[model samples]
Target: MISEPFANKKTWVHSLDPRLRVCTAFFLSCLFAITNQPVLAACALIASALLLGCSRPPLSALLRRLAGVNLFILFLWCSVPFFTPGTPIAKFGPLTCTQEGLDLVWLVTLKANAITLLLIACIGTMSASLLGHALQALRLPDKFVYLLLFTYRSLFVLADEWQRLQTALRLRGFVAGTNLHTYRTVGYLFGLTLTRSLDRAQRIHQAMLLRGFTGRFPAFVLLRFQRHDFLFAILTALFLIFLLFFWNNPFFP
Candidate 1:
């Protein structure tokens, strides 16, 4: 439920080359995965938090909106012990899940969440158009690229329509109750939304074809990077190296 700060005005991160942003995100994810010690991963997580703080959004905004999904991320750790087993740590009335499994749980949870935070940070810092342009420049398949672009574009349209529908329903005093009518109302909304979405997609596709779209999205490189870009990239690499090295290599553990 966290409000998206990604819609912020242009900042330094946004001004960088899209390739740098993408690479930074990938590098952070790798670092998070390589580190398993909770203390070390916690430090990495704190660093990411600081990075977000530097992005200039109020902390309250992220908590009020993003905290719920953040809680779900915390729960992702619950799965590790149920699947992985070794020596016992705590007995939950009778369950025999081990410390090793729980260590894995911490590892998985922190790794996934740290990466998610970075991804969110990047998405907020960079514009969708810039991201599309970057991917296109990377020589991604045109069909897939255009599909993603159009899909994202269509969402705002559909979302606006949905808001209008909700207002209309509210004005008419339509209410859901605990009965068959509730199910019927849900079904009606679903049908209406689906039909509207499909119709809108068809019209958009026809319009694109009319505009000479030959299964390719136009690519425009917006800006280029400088030596500073490499410096930031090297710093990101060093951060990853530090996190990964904090834990003793335990593949043979």
Candidate 2:
């Protein structure tokens, strides 16, 4: 079991088949992309929030994982009103904030937040191996899937090494502060990480070849299509049909 928030075993989300999660996430994403109303978007966000809580992933884990992205979201929101010009809701010389711009800001921000949550809801509960297996079963391109698998494995491996490098930096009084020297140091570290990642990739390919790695990866395990999956699929189809119709309805603004 994954010890992290998304790696839980208790929630209904964890119990769900991987394919269901993928479909649900993908469907919600499509819906979010096509719809542009605040209330409707809020509904989608609430649905995602429900899944997040239902999955029982750690709140702290979600917050931490989303921290860097949310920081950017905050910066984006702050800049929108100033740079986006429209009929003035408020005016400060050259900076006239418009109602449309503010509305647009909230619309994008909420939808983006919902999108992130929806993805986290899927990935947090799934192992990369399981996801790869799902891709294979779904008939995704074999070459790309193998590439994804190798990339996923390398990510964790490199993450461990990166942590070690960070520790070493700290031990030698390499503070993570903004300075020309620090930026240069980090740039060098990034370059080294990429180099090491390539080396590891080469080693893995050699090892796989030695172990009789063929042109194509072995087929993924089949997940049984349970009654629950059918139900979910049906319900989701209905929900999406309704959502699309409603989005197109004149009363839906």
Name the top lDDT candidate.
Answer: 2
Once all C-alphas are superposed, what RMSD does model 1 give against the true structure? 3.5
Which pairs of residues collide in candidate 1? 1-65, 2-65, 2-66, 6-124
Residue pairs in clash, model 2:
none
Candidate 1 vs. true structure, TM-score: 0.80
Backbone N/Cα/C clashes per model: 4, 0
For residues 49-141, what per-residue lDDT tens digits would candidate 1 score against the true structure?
776666665567566546765677666556567557788877776566787888877766666666666776666576677777877877788
The weakest ten consecutive residues by lDDT in model 1 span: 1-10
Residue 249 miss distance in model 2 (angstroms): 2.2
TM-score of each: 0.80, 0.82
lDDT of 2: 0.77
Tens digits of lDDT, candidate 2, 49-154: 8767777777777888678667887887778877776777887877778877888888887788788888888766887778877777778898888888777777
